[model samples]
Target: MGMLNTLLQAVSSAPIGGAIGAGIAAIGAGIGIGMIGKSACESIARQPEAASDIRGSMILTAAFIEGVCLFAVIAGLLAVLK
Candidate 1:
C-alpha cells in the first residue's frame, strides 16, 4: 500500500535510535501480553468457575497494554520523523 511505502521510506532515512525504540516497544508489549495470557490460563485452570471473569479481565488488561504499546511505538516513530 502507499502508506506502507511511505513508512518504509521514512524509516530508511531515519536514525537508528527511533527504530530501536520502536522494536523494544514491540518486544516489551509481546512479553507483557504473553505473561498476561499465561497468568490468565493458570488462573482459569485453578478456578474454572471464575473463568468468565478472568477472561474478561485478561482481555481488558491486554487491550490496555496494547494501547500503551501503540503510544510508545508512535513516540518512537515521531522521534524518527524528527
Candidate 2:
C-alpha cells in the first residue's frame, strides 16, 4: 500500500507526461502529412494531367492536420501548466 501510494504521487507530480503527449501529437502530424504527400504523388503518377489539383488538395489536407496538431500541442502545454 505504501509503495502504491508513492508511485501514484510520483506520477501525479510529474509534468513529463504532458510533454510526451505533445511529442506524440507532433509525430502523428508528421505521419499524417507524409501520407498525404505519398498519396498525392501516387495520384499524380497515375493521372499526370490532374497533378495540380491533387497537389492543391494534398496541401490543404496537410494544413488541416497541422492545425489540429498545433491545437493538440497547445492543449498539452496547458495541461503541463496546470
Candidate 3:
C-alpha cells in the first residue's frame, strides 16, 4: 500500500502528461492543416475557376485551427507550470 501510494504521488506530480498533451495538440493541428491544404488544392485542380475561393476558405480554416491549437498549447503549459 505504501509503495503504491508513493508511485501514484510521483505520477500525479510529474508534468509529463501536460507536455505530451501539448505535443499531441500541435501534431494534430499540423495534420489537420495539411489535410485542409491538400483538399483545397484538389478542389482547385478540379475547378480551376474557383481556385481563389478555395484558397481563401482553406486559409481561413487553417487560421481557425491554428488559433485553437495556440489555446490548447497555452492551457497545457499552464497545467505543467502550475
Best by TM-score: 3
Candidates 2 and 3: which is better by TM-score?
3
Model 2 per-residue lDDT tens digits across residues 17-49: 888899999999999999999999999999999
Instruction: Tell me the TM-score of each prediction against the true structure.
Output: 0.80, 0.81, 0.85
Query: Which candidate leads in lDDT?
Result: 1
- Weakest lDDT window of 10 consecutive positions for candidate 3: 10-19
Give RMSD to native, each candidate.
9.2, 2.6, 2.4
Decreasing lDDT order of the candidates: 1, 3, 2
- Pairs that collide in candidate 2 are none
Q: Give the runs in model 3 whose Cα sits over 4 Å from its true position.
A: 1-14
Looking at model 3, how many pairs of residues clash?
0
- Model 2 gets an lDDT of 0.91
The list of candidate 1 runs beyond 4 A from truth reads 1-14
Off by over 4 Å in 2: 1-11
39 in model 3: Cα distance from truth in Å? 0.2
The per-residue C-alpha lDDT of model 1 at residue 15 equals 57
lDDT of 3 by residue, 9-64 (tens): 88787677778888999999999999999999899999999999999999999999
